[model samples]
Target: MPMNDADAHVAAQIRAVLAAAEAGGGVAPIVEAGDPILRQTTRPFDGQVDDAELAQLAEVMRATMLAAPGVGLAGPQVGIGLSMFVAEDPGSLDPETAEVRQRSPMPLRVVLNAEYTPATSENVAFFEGCLSIPGYQAVVARPRSIELTGVDLNGTPIAEVVAGWSARIVAHETDHLDGIMYLDKAEMRSLSTNTSVAKFWNQPSTQQAASELGFTLPSSMLL
Candidate 1:
């Protein structure tokens, strides 16, 4: 597909950011919540960026995510309105936290044009945070499992059934492509600062947080 004017402008901006990062030997600066790019629907990953550029972008994105020490990152978070993201999890939680959150390790994955659907009726509420929205966390009820489909940088197809914390990561990152932030779906009353979360709400499950914060989780999770 040909790049429309708006997409062309975005592509230029993306290439410029990549070039600056390569020249400066620094990671891409993550854009914060108020950026218009983060609120815009992303363009599909056509050939707007060449293979070499795409590879460089991926490398830079990976480096940025690691530097941010975040489990996932999206294009919009870096000021590129493109449907792409990288995700990985070391799964280094303690046994109790791991068991309660169903968190497991995930190898680094770069997904383009991603989309997901709920794989089960069950919903889980957790204190989810985002790189774009730094310093705050909120309780969000999301499907416990999801069917994810997308393509890789090489244009290879990607399809998988993701569950547990990985599923939440997938949903969260994919939502970025559609101009959706986790805050849009979060329980407003359950919002907490990072310090507060560490001090008061750092539990394996969100049940206590929900109770004390005066918010409710999905009824499905109550069963």
Candidate 2:
């Protein structure tokens, strides 16, 4: 299918970004939070680029996410206003921490035009940091499980219920597609610098941080 004018423009921009990234050692510079691109809703994928180009784009996104050492990366974070993201977690946390967060290994996956909704009323709070924000972490309550729907790079449909840390990952990435940031729903009082988070708020759960920082957790999480 031929791209419309808007899609063609976006495709050209994407190609330019990819070319620049390749020229600059294969990793695109992550756009910061203040960029307008990060604030606008992303455009959905439609044959803007061919399958081979899309695959290359996904690979570059994967490499960028890994290099950022972040579990997720959305197109807007790299200055492309596309509804796509890459996510993966090595599940490297210690057993106790992993159990507390319900975190496990998540293989690298690319999701395009993704959206999600709560699959259960249960909510969980944990500190999250974004690469675009770079140096701050805050506690955000999110659905413990979610039904995510989207397509893969090959345009295969994806519909699944994901829980625990995986759910959080999907929720965060999907929000980018709609121009929402985690901080928008976060407990501002629970915000802390990366150093502060490491020195004071490092724990399996947010209970200690919430109590000490004068913030409150969801009723379900309160002991």
Candidate 3:
């Protein structure tokens, strides 16, 4: 599908942001995964949104997701350790080609330091990946619908209901900024699809990281 003017504009902005990050001038700075900041639940910024910084973040997220080959990306995943994520609306798939194509339905929404409340008790499971953990994926259970409240990239407050895959995307990315991984909420070994988890664990450092993180490998993660 042809992109509209607004969509095209956002795409262009995303590209520019990513380019700057690649040049080492866009993102604020990198933080280690186990840093204290990553563990705390992210709080909404009280002051006005800095358009320049927010724009850079959105661009970095977009670029990071594209580079990592994932549908969504959060700020912490890129090492910025902030309450932000840039996600393509999971429901906006383009059915024209063999490869899946999706766009942000709300024109690149930037949920800043958001909080999520499930609107429905109905739960669903989906395959999820992370930009922080490259070359791995898992089947994680998530709420089918949610009521999320947060400020946008421009710092405008929003409290809206979302359903389908969009809710999942938002919830998954939000957790990243809070330093929570999907494995933290996963129910069983089958939810994990990390094919290389065993191999990676065979190495001493990787094994140590897994052990330190308290991640157990699932024998079989899929049906």
Candidate 4:
């Protein structure tokens, strides 16, 4: 049965609390690194998608992302092996209106077995982070634009073009589904708090830029 309205509301409240906590303080303990599952790349669900099971997993994914205050998350990150993921582009917050609008030009896509084809010739560098490996970030080179094809939450196929930070986020989470880490593909990497990341987002490159700033970069970033 679907979650009742009251139950859903309460769950949303709890998720909001967890998200706030994660955004400010950081995530609580989850799966440990080198737990075998993290290293295993997941296979697509070959059988029919069970609506009930899909709903349950989708809820878990959303709650997990909220709890982590992340832009996107994958099933494998939560220790599941199916090809599924959740994404919410936390784009820009309208201060006066208090309305949150998606910053990415692309739609908020729920992707399954999503693949990417770069549209632009050159890639752009963006500082990326992950919930699985908290307090660490790196400058990863991602396509300026991409064409994505995947199944939606309802198992409906979709093909769309995405660009900018939105493209980066989708690709990042999709990599999780494929058992790849952002650090594995980054040009340079560091670990720090959101405060530090925001502070140094656009500063001119300097010796200071070479190392992690603001939030201390942990010697060992992975849990």
RMSD of each: 1.5, 1.1, 11.2, 10.3
**Candidates sorted by TM-score, descending order?**
2, 1, 4, 3
C-alpha TM-score for every candidate: 0.95, 0.97, 0.63, 0.69
Q: State the lDDT of candidate 3 residue by residue for 1-223, as single tens digits.
A: 5655543444444454456676864442334346565565543453323477457667766755655556777665654435677777434344431122122353456777788889987665544566555556554667767899888866688899977667878888888767788767764443333674454432312224334445543323112
Q: Which residue pairs clash in candidate 4?
A: none
lDDT of 1 by residue, 1-223 (tens): 6778977987797798797787767688899999988889998887887899888888888889999879999999988988999998998469999998999999999999999999999999999899999999999899999999999988999888999999999999999999999999999999999999999998898888888889988887663
Which residue pairs come into collision in candidate 2? none
Looking at model 3, residue 147 earns an lDDT score of 93
Number of the predicted model whose lDDT against the real structure is largest: 1
Q: lDDT of model 1 at residue 72? A: 96
Against the true structure, whose TM-score is highest?
A: 2
Per-residue lDDT over 28-97 for candidate 2, one digit per residue giving the tens place of the 0 to 100 score: 7888888888888888998888888888888888888889889999988887888999999998458988
Residue-level error in angstroms, candidate 1, position 197? 0.5
**Which scores better on lDDT, 2 or 3?**
2
lDDT of 3 at 201: 32
Instruction: Give the C-alpha miss distance for residue 70 in model 3, angstroms.
Output: 1.8
Stretches of candidate 2 off by over 4 Å are none
How well does candidate 2 match the true structure in TM-score terms?
A: 0.97
Q: Give the runs in model 3 whose Cα sits over 4 Å from its true position.
A: 1-37, 89-107, 191-223
